[model samples]
Target chain A: MVDDEADLAEAIGKALRREGYAVDVVHTASEALEITVYTPYDLISLDLTLPDGDGRTICRTIRAEHEHQPRILMLTARDDIEERVAGLDDGADDYLVKPFALPELFARVRTLLRRDADVAIGAELEIAGLRLDTAAHRVVWKEAEIDLTAKEFSLLRFFMTNADDVHSQEQLLEHVWDAAADPFTNTVRVTVGTLRRKLTAATGLQWIETVIGAGYRFVKEPVPG
Target chain B: MGRIRLPSFAETIRFRLSLAFAVVVFAVGAAAIAGVFLYENSTLVEPVIMAEKKIVRDLATGELTEVSVIFPEESQRVMAEKVELDAYRRALNSLRTSSFLALGILFLAAFGSGWFLSGWALKPVRSMTAVAQGITGSDLGRRIGMTGPRDEMRDMGDTFDSMLDRLEVAFDDQRRFVAEASHELRNPLAVARTNLELALQGGDDEEIRTAAAIAYDAATRMSGMVDELLDQARESLPVNASETVDLGDLARSVVQDFRASARQRGLRLEVRADPVEVTGDRLALRRAAVNLVSNAIRLAPEHSTVTVSVAKAEDGRAQLAVEDVGPGLTPDQRTRVFDRFWQGEGQEGRGAGLGLAIVKRIAERHGGTAEVVPAGDGSRFVITI
Candidate 1:
């Protein structure tokens, strides 16, 4: 559990610990990033507005560094649809607004954990000509090995899971960052462009399509070899 | 004897009522004068004629010489002349006195009748004026009661009452909307604050980063909800200006945007158009179309299809239809599908339940209507403009 409020962080940590999950509480975004390098957490709860940097950037950094990312649930008081969409787009598994019932928070946390467990167990997911081997963390295009960074791999994995779907930048951030980040940040685009370049260089095919005024899409449209 | 105000109570009533009263009085007074004039003329002329007859009778009988002849004292001839003169004078005096009295009485009666009748007739108008004065912005609900027989006043009161009813309902809805909006907004603000407070307290880099991530997500969702609500509110208002909008293009664009979200859920979103056009506000119409498409995306099941088609109906009205291969609504659900906060059973997680209601309001604003009908094993929403 991480929050600027000591009381809230402590309270949330105790609640999680009571539920049989080991919990660690952090205060600032910068400190939270530092701790992730040493501790392997099962789940993370994030708030968007922070004293240091925004939570979205932290989500991006986490996705970039972590091998097995923890399940993330965003807690916020913002009830706007765009914010919710942006949170989901950022890479957060789920979101709960502030003043929310504790039972609801617990339920969402459980749901994310269950989903993370399922994702951990699933070995491979295939879409069109693209294949992702979760166990190996590798991508193959028509049996050709494609080298990718951790962020690229995660982005590709998210796209494959939701193939032919247009995701807004905010949505990409939410999914990539565990929905605990700012969607307004352009980090998703830079990362996507980089990932697209790598994928294109390796496979000589532009698999990821940009849907203008929307986000990005992974359609099965074949590029000329 | 006090200084009277110009157009005092009596004068105002007299001005309004005196015309008809004066006409009646004049006709009656003229007839009375004519009758009295005729009666006095006959009475005075008859006595004079009787005296003339007595004199003529004496003269014809040669009872006395023409001049200086001894005439009998108190004779019928001598007496007839003297009485004739007195009778003429008395008749003139009596006629003048009675005519003056009659005129005076008629004038007084006319003024009194005019004042009383005008006051009686204007009572309803005065009450109406009072009610009108009370119907300000803060007191729009008050209505004037007719309080009389079924006539023009009743019609006026009924009309006023109906107008007040509509205004009251409109004001009440506005208040409820504002309250709901404020309540919804409070949630996100609280979350953002909590996140900021936690970030400042100092934690491990990972924990801090995670907290930051969660906070960002919350802020984004809150902003989106607020934007959507504001957009809906704006579109629901009646457009003050109108322009020709290409319904086909608008429908296609909205669908194109949602295509990806639909595909992600394994749902196919298709748009078909026939170059339909309508006169309306472009932004408002687009919002309405987007709302419908969004709703379809939410309601359609995974691995199903949502189709949006725009065309002209047989009646030359522009029509747009969004069809989804999802569980359709029941009869009861369809009845209030467009009512605010009307959520169907099993639709708790779908949305805020304001989509259809906003769409309906927009449609009405544009002189159009939205209806949900069963279509192809699911539901189809048709908007005609």
Candidate 2:
């Protein structure tokens, strides 16, 4: 989130973090740009007016520069049609006028994430014998429901979407974790290990395989009986 | 739409102008023709008929005698005089007829051309009327934009266009003021709502306390904004200008009011008075002075001096100025510093942002001007009436 109002930005960041989405907050366009250069965010809630620069220009520059496109949700005090149209035309994915409900913002964020994941809103993802409902945030191994933490759930969702493909620890860190995460940490491995153990305990099958000198990949199918 | 009802011919400017033109042309043409005729008549000399010498063969002397014979029945002088009078009468009659004919032609030509020329000349006025009638408060952007050589009609059009320009600007300012007011209110409202919502979410004691604190701050900001808005409205109201206000006294009172606050902030309040007086609202002028002094105290550096000066300028305008040893306004900021709700660079939520605007309003209400005087390393705000 980028807003000149530091208090509002902090409040929104705390709320999003409570919802299990890693969030980073900044107060100026320059700071936002400087940070986005290193860590690619999943979605950015940008305030239209900023002290250093316009949010639309920043959105446009992010779209032009980043290979991994981040969804831009513009937050503007102006509810006029022209402001919204200009923001969207300048590469904003959506806009929420100021003084909006927190619940509505959360819902829009969820929808944007689902869109980014290439899944329908509130749709259930089923691969082989594993089933996960994104809206309910539930996971079922075979017929047994498995409980998971927010991070584990996020990791599982990421692995399921890109099943059979290898993702390095850095890639997972960049995608699942926010810019605040330390790059040198083993949080990704630890979370992935925990997720694997949880899935194996439920179905008694090893669902994740680690290729030596490479990275982790989710098994697309259960082992043949 | 129904056609406009035309005024009577006599009531129309074109008709009156044409009639006036015809009258003038007739008068001048008749006088010129009559003068030439009179001059010709005055120069007409009666012809002299002299007695004729007749060589008559007398009955007795055949070829010797030549006699002057005058007829008794016909007087040669009278006959000559009658012929001359007849010729003069004919010439005068022709002259009179041609003169009248020429005068009539001149009057008709003058009236016709006058009617056409008047209509052509009034075309701009017609367009100006059309433009004026078509304009409304919401549609103030239309301008005559009349392009022509400088004339009375063009000057009127230009004046009208300039007036419209000013009106459009004022209207736009009003709209923007309302929008900014709403936006200002909404920002704090949003902050308060978010903070209260978070506080209600059953966070830890410290987190809840922080949320409540932020919410309280937002509420304070909203109240401040409301109060400032009220102050602005009050300042815009017509001041009771029946009383005389001494600027020196007003500045001293303002200085006294802000002295404690300045001392508390580790600042000095200095005063220079010259006993300048003006006829205006005393309360309004005091408010203006108080605003300037308070602003200077707020912005001036600690341990620096804020000088409140009241004097008559060189042109004999009564003036009150507050000079602060603070971060001076830049050229860009100077232009907009007096604008309503104009925030200083990165100084959001510091104040209600209407102080300068109110001061400006008060200054203008007294038929005066407010300005920021350039300083080497500080700022000075002056109100002169």
Candidate 3:
């Protein structure tokens, strides 16, 4: 768990522990990232607002380094519709707004944990001539390897995994960066743009399509032989 | 003079009724005074004049000498010009005094009657207002009873009660919708999550990857559903009265945010400036504009330009328009566009279908409106605020 509110973090950690899961609590996204480097976690409950940095950035960093990426559940007080959508789009497994009932919180954690059980822990994904190996953190398109920054790779992986769906910029921010990051910032756009350019240059194909006002859509339509 | 505060609902009812009562009492009092004056002039004073004339003739003809006059000289006259004049003056003086006293009594009676009558007439209304004020969102079912006749006040109360009934029903439906939608979304999300967890528990890499993908999809869909519910819930809230916002600047910022996406899609996104200003909730207005421009970009084909323009309309109304080069909506689609949850054929199941509806509601709340107009090979969504 990552949150600036010590009491809240402690309470959440206790609840998770009671649910039979080992819980590690941190007050800032930076600390959360530092801890995750040495100690692997199965699930991460993140608060978007933190004293040091945003949880979304930490989520991206973890997704980049870890072999089996832990599930993420974003906790935020801001209930704006766009913010929630942005959190989901960025790569968070789920999200809950503040003043949430504890039962609901526990339910969400259970749901995430149960879902993690169904997935093959370290499997690679391939679609539309693009390949992603989760264990290796490597991506290949049209038999050519693509090099991506930690943030870019996580973003591309999220896109390719959820192909043909529209994502809003707000969604991108939440799922791709620390929850504490400024939502109004256009970091997602700049990063996505850079990632798209790099992918196109490496694969020689236009895979990511802008859905206009909506967000972005990863079009996995195969090029004709 | 002391400052007078406007009366509360109860007080206002009492005051109005009292005023009406005072008018009626004044009219009746005036009629009574006129009747009294007429009787004194004709029946009493006129007959006395005739008798006095007969007595005066008898005294002149000497039929009786040294008559003992019970009345004073003025009163004994039989058309005695000087005496009649003096008698007339005395009678007029008495009449004037009596009339003045009667008027004073009538005014006092009228005021007392008005005060009591007003209180009596307004008792039910006061109670009804109190009952109405006690109602809250949770207890919208409570209503004032229509205990009186089918008069205007009763009609007004009945109308008010029925309005509350309608609101209660609407609120009930909304709450149910939110609950049902959330439940529906949760089930699928749970199933997907469970599957992903099982796959993760296994050591198979390919199965884990497939499970992860499915989980992500389910989660995304659930998020979308929740967002829709939230929008629906907020739609019914009263508009917030906040600081002024520059519509032009807001439009520009939203357009700029989407410019990169537009470029990536091989489309142009431009913001035209006219510096239209409006007073409203800046966040809401920005969201409205973002939804409009985003919708435009989605429909516009690659290489087509999407223009966002802000200016004052011909009617001195502030206007913000988002135009795009895409398949224009049919007349039917255009008509249904602003309707809640009404999506065009191709766009069905794509978005929450609440974007345009939200925009329309926001515009209406700001004493403005939104409409779709024909544009260059596409359509323009114009809002006046």
Candidate 4:
């Protein structure tokens, strides 16, 4: 979340964090750009006006520089049609006017993320016999429903979306954790460990496997037996 | 589709001017020609005497002597002069007919030239009308910009352009004021809304408390902004300015009201009053005094005195002023001190910035003036009626 209004930015950041999304808040365009240089966000909530620079220019810079362009959701106090159209024309995926309800903002963020990950809205992610309903944040192993914390659910969602790929701890931190997380910490490993235990305990099979020298990957399917 | 109708010719200035021209020209020409014809006719009717040389027999002389005789015979002289009179009468009748004929032709020629000349002369007015009609509140930049030798019509066009210049500036200021007001309103509104949403989302007690506090602050800010907006609107309204308001009483009341607030800020409220009366709206005058005192209290340093004074000026006008010993305004700030939404340096988020502007409006509505009085130690504001 990027906004010159510090209070609004913090509130939105807290709400997004509660929704199981790792959210970082910044009050200026300079800080927003500085953070984006290191972290590859899937979607960005951008306020149209910032202290250091205009949000549209920041949006354009992000679009031009970032190899993996984050989906930008513009938040502006101006509700004029021309501003909205210009925002979208400048590469904003969506926009919300100021004084918008939290639920509406959350919905837009979720939609943008889903679109970014190429996941169907409200669709359940299934790999082998493990099924995850992203919208409800529910996990099901065969017929038994599994409960997960917000962080664990987010990690599982990321894994299920990229079912057969290896992601390093640093890579996981960049995508799954906000910028506030320590780079040299073991949080990502611990989270992956806990997530693995939960999946194994429920299905009697190890879903996440760590290669000898590579990062962990989620298996697309378990052995037939 | 509606039927097209042409403009009425008689109603146009061109047609009216042309008709007047034709009438004047025809009248003058006919009068001069008729005078000349009348004089010629009067001279032509008189009989001319003739002398004839003829052989006549002298009664007293037997021999016939040749003699010139004057024709005194009335019948023969009438016969001889009758042909000349007839010719002169024929020439006078032709002169009368042809003089009138020339006058009639001159009237037609004058009317045609007058119509064209009037139309040519009104071209600038037509352009000015077109330019005026094209202007609206949203689009104010169009100018007549008449380029010609300075004349009445050109002068009018230049005056119109200058008026539009002033109007455009005023309109731009109004638009900027509205935009700033909305922006100000939106900030607090967004803060309150987001915080309330967070608080209602069933967070922990500490988080909820924080959100509630932030939301409360936002609500207060928004209410303050709304109050200032309301005050501005009310001050701008036309009110009866015939009431005899005592300036001293108004200042004393304002000082009394702000006494506690001023003390809380560690500022002293001093009122020096002499009975002075001004004709204006009592409520508006009181509001202006209150605004000045409150601003002084807000800006003055701790332990400083804020003097509220009301008295009759040397010029016999009533004056009410508030002076504070704090940071004095710069030269630039002093000039724009009463402009809408103008805040002091380093006081970005102080108030809505409409208090001084409202005071100025009230002063003007009462046929008075509000001004910033320069001081060595601090700043002062005065309203004179």
Candidate 5:
């Protein structure tokens, strides 16, 4: 992890280390660049603005130097979606905005790491009192197993995978259902409504948030009923 | 005791200009009146006075000896002419006073006309002053719509209005940024707080691990947000990094980075760039290019190809274009695509919809432009420097 904030770096380091990932922490951009240059880390949690240089630059330098570049998860105070997209463009595998829930961070890291199938093929996605097993395609919410249709499960996975970020119905349809734009389809909304009802019934936690004229925003940490 | 009315002499452009006009009028009017008075005195009065004296001298010796005191031809004539000369002298004195009076009237007229003309010519300037004075950070809508014959005063007003236009645009971008920043800042902090609390109130190791992992993510996000905010703070300054950046190399490097993600999404990110160099900030240019690519990737379909090309335009401007064959943008979307936080239908959660805005800013900073060039399949984002 590359961060200037001591307490935040320590806390995040401790949390990720518990997930069986060997993590290293750096306080300055220089140290980050130095460590990244030498060590082949699995992932680098970078702060965009650093004491020495910009995190985006560091991300670029890493991508330039390393043949097998480690996945980069950008952490920044920039909450703009364009900044996030730009971060990804700058070689960051994922991005999270400031003061975000640890659960959301976990989800992002897990998603990035999961991209490397060799390392994380069947890792479980855990959101307080809720767990998703990718290999078994099973969900246990509040210690109770809930039946889900394949489409519903796919939709839930997408929402869970990208927790705390809003996703439009079109985007949801594109990612979850591999079909191109069919302007007449309301399948995404119907599926989401069913998933929200089922999840709420079982876990007693409301997780899906609808943004008007936008799309659905999934809660990083489940909201208690 | 009465209230004292104090004069306010300010260095305002309007006051200075009006004073200048009044002074010029006074100088020209005074000179004209003085010339007329001097010419009239020399031509009409001086010769007449001299001839009258000569006649008096002639009468004093020869004609006076043979004169009858009763008839008194030479003496009476000389005396009457003397009274007439006195009258002429009084008339001359009156002319001199009248010239002074005319000068005094001219001074007042010059000053009044100068003040009136300056005010009339500077109506736009006064409006500009009001706008400049009344404008604050929040209110950027004031304008000096000067309409008149094309003159310097009108030009200044137009220039001032254009300047305000630029300012309003810049402020609009920053203002929207601040609003979005506030809303976004809360989410990550809330995320971190909740996860930390969950970790603190954990019952099982799995719960603690999940909570801690999430908390870590949030902290990372928060620090990154701070970084982004700092970057925006520094964005007001022009890009001072002057380097020989090879546009082709920059495009290639970006393409190489996104190669994996493109493949993962079953989309192709192709770079057809020629070796081109432009003097600019590398980081900024790279970001501009990256925003284009990222936007294309987001909007493009799974099987569609996203092309990022760098070449020289006909005008010798180094150009970068990112084209994607996806659901094409409508006229409305194209218009507002660069507006801050403008997420068109189904465009939310895409980095606050600021990709195009940043690209435009970066392009502008490089003394260039970013716009959409109509493409065959979908939309093409073009940045020319």
Candidate 6:
């Protein structure tokens, strides 16, 4: 975690370390850049405003220097819209505005860390007779191979990976779709609907359940017909 | 909207002009008539004077008798002299009549032309006034664009245009300062909110939790209400350290800050940015963009996404936009959204309703504007700076 405020930084570091993850706290932008250059850490919690330099520059420089970059989660006291956009553009994978809850911060860190470890963790996923091969970009349901668009494939993988957890259209867009995907577009909804219909047609089971105004949840149990 | 009054006799340039013309023509006509009358009178009297002088000489020499015949035709000379005198009297009367008639004609002609000529000469002034009248408080961007010979009226038009330009800038600066002031105050509140919420989590004991809740409520009250009041009281901040800023970069950074809150609420905050440059106070621009995006996220439904886009508008302006897929604003809502201290229906505790106003102000400072346009099932709030 990188922050200029010592007290806040220490608090965040303690909270993060309590989650059984090794954490290092740094004060200045220079120290942040130095540590990331030497150590190949799994994740970095970066502050936007620092003592020596700004956070966005540090994020960009680190991204350029490190070939296999750590998952960068920007921590900024500035919670305005454009600042957040700049942090993401500066190459941070995720961001948390200051005054954020420790649990919420941890959830984001965990999410980013899981993504970092995603490719290495497994090549195949099996849930409720539906199998997904992460490396091959393939899915099989009830002994039948299913055709999927790249986005649909990723959407299915995300749903399967975070089974029983609800996913919003926005979360799906961020995770499954490309960076250029417009958030205002209904593509996420349309793709999810198509993917669900296709999966149900293949196996006669609805794996993804709509939670209405909340979001979509991946059902662990069989469809309650 | 005040009515354009017909120029009263006292105020109209037309009247003043025509009066001046009429007075000059009348004076010159009176002088000419008097001079001609005097010359004619002198000529007529000169002949009479010569005859009278002859009679006086004859009387003195005893050659003239009142009732004596002086020749073969007794009354011939006397009758001839009487006829000559009568002819002079008729000529003098005719001259007097013609002199008055000439004066009347000239005066009428002078007044007619004076009315039309003044209108023609002041044509530029009238048009310049029309342009000025059209400028309302709602729209200050219009310029006279006056084109004409370089004269007094043109100079006036140019001066008015320059005045409007300065006024627009001054209004813009005032707006930017107001926006920045609110954000400056709110920053600490936002930070306090997070720290309080964090403190609340650490205490699982009921008493401690109660204490934390009180503190959280106090912060919320302070931030959501009191802070706004204080900000309004302070009104404006110093001129933001103006600099050349990358608008796209600034927008992206604000989105990064909202990412966590968006995630926690099951909403996704995403950004589409291009490297667009502009000269402005970076801090103020960021605050404006932040307000817009914050409004979007607050209004957007769960499972929906709030998208921020930064690019160059068609007019070569740096643009930042935040789109929400929530309930689109009503016509009334859209109109009133920028009004200071106005809250929407059911917007009791969210904010002090200064967000959009600040956005508008910031945009103005950058020589641009902020607007909300209806889209799909929501609204797109755009700031072109």
Question: Which residues of candidate 2, in runs, are more than 4 Å off?
Answer: A66-68, A123-136, A140-144, A160-165, A203-207, A218-225, B1-169, B238-242, B346-349
B8-51, model 2: which lDDT tens digit per residue?
A: 77788879988998899889888888788878888777665456
User: How many backbone collisions does model 5 have?
Assistant: 27
**Which residue window of length 10 is worst by lDDT in model 3 chain B?**
B47-56
Score candidate 1 by TM-score against the native.
0.47
Per-residue CA lDDT of model 4 for B226-314, tens digit only, reads: 89988887775788567888888878888888889988988989999999987888888888888898888888888989898888889
What lDDT score goes with residue B195 in model 3?
50
Question: Every prediction's TM-score for the first chain?
Answer: 0.51, 0.88, 0.51, 0.91, 0.53, 0.53
Q: Could you tell me the lDDT of residue B186 within candidate 4?
A: 83
Q: Model 4, stretches more than 4 Å misplaced?
A: A3-7, A26-74, A78-96, A101-166, A179-225, B1-7, B46-77, B91-101, B194-220, B233-251, B262-289, B295-350, B356-385
TM-score of 5: 0.43
Cα lDDT of model 1 by residue, B1-385, tens digit:
9886665644664465775786688678978788877786776542222211222235567674333333354366556876886878787888789887878778778867876877777777788879888887656878886776888867877788788889988887786776566645554455555455545555568766766776776677567667768776776566966888899999888988998888887888888998987888887788788888888787788889888999888889889999997788878778989987555654423344577888888788888899999886789999998
Q: Give per-residue CA lDDT, model 6, range A201-223, as digits (tens).
A: 88888788889897999887758
Binned by DockQ into CAPRI classes (incorrect, acceptable, medium, high), candidate 5 is: incorrect
lDDT of 6 by residue, B53-89 (tens): 2233365676764442245353566577678878988
lDDT of the candidates, in the order given: 0.72, 0.83, 0.71, 0.84, 0.75, 0.73
lDDT tens digits by residue: candidate 4, A1-225: 898777888888888888888888888889989988878888888988665678999999998887778889998787767789999999999989888999888778767766634334365777776788766678888789997888999998888777778988887888789888998889999999999988888888878889767898888876532
- A best-first ranking of the candidates according to their DockQ comes to 2, 4, 5, 1, 6, 3
Regions of candidate 6 where Cα sits further than 4 Å from its true position: A1-225, B1-11, B38-105, B120-176, B193-385
* Candidate 1 structure quality by residue, lDDT tens digits, A71-143: 7777754566777788777777788877665556766765565454323335566655667775456788888
The local lDDT score (0 to 100) that residue B218 gets in candidate 2 is 86
| lDDT, model 6, position B291 | 83
Alpha-carbon shift of residue B211 in model 5 (angstroms) = 3.0
lDDT of 5 by residue, B1-385 (tens): 9977546653555566666766676778778877876785675432222222222234555552332233445556667777876787788788878877876777667666766776776677667878799988879888877887898978888898898899999898776778677755665565567457556844378867876777677667657566556655666568878999999999999989888878887997888999999999998888888878877887788978999999999999999999988778888778888986555554423354556777888899888999986687698999999
Considering DockQ, which of the candidate structures 1 and 4 is the better prediction for this target?
4
Candidate scoring better on lDDT of 3 and 6: 6
